[model samples]
Target: MKSILRLAAATVCAFTLLALQAVTAQQVQIEGSVNLTPFEARGITLSTLYKVDGEFAGKQGIAVPAPFTLAAPRRDGQQILAQAKPAGGGPIKIYFATDDPQKRIFSSLQIIPFTMKTDDPQKRLEIGDYFAIDLLKKLGENRTTRVNLRRQVTVGGLPAAEVVGNFVNAEGDQLLVRLVAVAKPGSPHGIIGIAVGHPRQGRIKKVEDIYDTSASLAFDTVTFN
Candidate 1:
């Protein structure tokens, strides 16, 4: 009788283990695939375009993925300014709020094109700092410190640099930024992907997604000049 009872307990444990395995398998299946889009500049391709599981929108030179819906595409001189928002939602106009609704506030992704030879960390920071200056100028404000920097990182197998930090504008509103500079070896021109987050308490979560998405960005096709 003791032997039979021991055998029954063993059977129960086996079934429980199988049930846990099944749950784990289901979770792995639900996590979606990584999807990326391509971007081009100056008749040459650059490794500075990417995203996950989203559709692309915007007309003309400004092309970006969804959840980043653009109101319209306009070029401010050589720079392209596209007012973007999440789909199925209105413009993210609220600056600082405490909920998901406010989190969708209007944000923009600014792409700047330039040519550089090296992929050094300090050089990348300088480039990123220059971008911050341009961004602040666009907002008609200045002064940003507390920069978070990363270096020697690869974006789609190409060397890249990333900087994330915040700055207070003229209105005393804080704006978070995640900017990545991607450089492909032997290419004269490189591209920078900047996603500026709305100044709010819970904006970090979404801003992180944008940063992660951009890390996988690369040109779909490359052409040499």
Candidate 2:
């Protein structure tokens, strides 16, 4: 009965592997006082409108429009609006909060249309560097600092970067910020995704889970319309 025993062992191994995969693939959830509505991922087509003189009249200039998907969470008491461009599409503000800065939730994806001059090989940009520049502008030189950074590829095999860190808000509270960026060669715009959450030690897991879910949903579910 040696052959029968071998078959039984193989079956047991197969089942064990599947059980491990299921555990690791479990869905992540947010845990904290502030609850956020689930994020919905969707795709939209983009196109440019032109005047009779061929003048640039589209929200995204004269570039040919394409389709891209973005994920965003529903805002409390606010209606979601979509804006389209030749290279990007998403809500005006992915997340917003009032009265308390620490309680704010955010997730967003955007594509930056790069001009011919900026797209040159010599001038090509690393996604994370672009994010740091933008953050400096918004948070000022003294308030923004790079905490943890990693260079990784997106699910679509596109070049990408991710950074998780903290910045001081105007109210003097430390807030955590997470950013992910993806770039495709010769594209009109590079994709930039961002998420922000609470900074308390007990809430760090929830904040990170939110960011992970937002990024996973956007990258894994996005499709060309």
Candidate 3:
């Protein structure tokens, strides 16, 4: 009778283990078929463009529509200014929140063309990472005091990189800077970079706030020709 009981207990344990394995297999199959990244699962779609007067309007080939107004151009007839002799590619386009350089917030956009093929998502992301780091360096010019955040993100359905840091400008004022670089969707030979800078204690107090505002106003609304 004792031997019979032992055999019964072993059978029950085997069945329980089999049941657990079956459940785990099912879960794995479900996850594989419905794979989703955290950002995608959260339904975050970043864009900087909006419609305005039935026409898209933003600097650097991006625009937006009504109910979304961009920061006032620095001065009349100079809403968009070009920065000459950029590190590479075409001149960088800049838009300022105010005319006063001491207390103003500014954002810039640039399109950098590349010769390498970037059809693969991973390759594109790698290129974007490189551009992002390069952009940060150009912005800081070796005077960065602290870096707050630097990580990968998805922008307009493309892999991108974002960097936020604090640096002292030529004017000797500490400024917060946010930069993002992403491969242009459907365009394998180009990358788009967007950057924002403001006084460290300016109206926008948080680095993430700066990033979010730029995304909604300029980065998210970009459209390439």
Whose TM-score is greatest here? Answer: 3
Full-model lDDT for every candidate: 0.35, 0.36, 0.42
The C-alpha local distance difference test score for the whole of candidate 3 amounts to: 0.42
List the candidate 3 regions with Cα displacement exceeding 4 Å. 1-92, 99-115, 141-145, 212-216
Tens-digit lDDT string for candidate 1 (1-225): 334324322311221100000011112111112223243232323222222113322321233221221111111121111222322121221111122322233344444444443445556445544543443334323344346554445555555666666556555656666556554355434445555555343434543543422211222121212
- What digit string (tens of lDDT, one per residue) describes model 2 on residues 4-43? 3243223112211000010111221111122232343222
Ranking by TM-score: 3, 2, 1
Clashes of each: 3, 1, 13
Model 2 score (lDDT): 0.36
- Report the lDDT tens digits of candidate 3 across residue range 134-195: 55555445755577888887655656767677666555666665656565566544444445
TM-score of 2: 0.46
Q: What is the C-alpha RMSD of each candidate to the true structure, in Å?
A: 24.1, 19.2, 22.9
Lowest summed lDDT window (length 10), candidate 1:
15-24
Q: Can you give the TM-score per candidate against the true fold?
A: 0.41, 0.46, 0.53
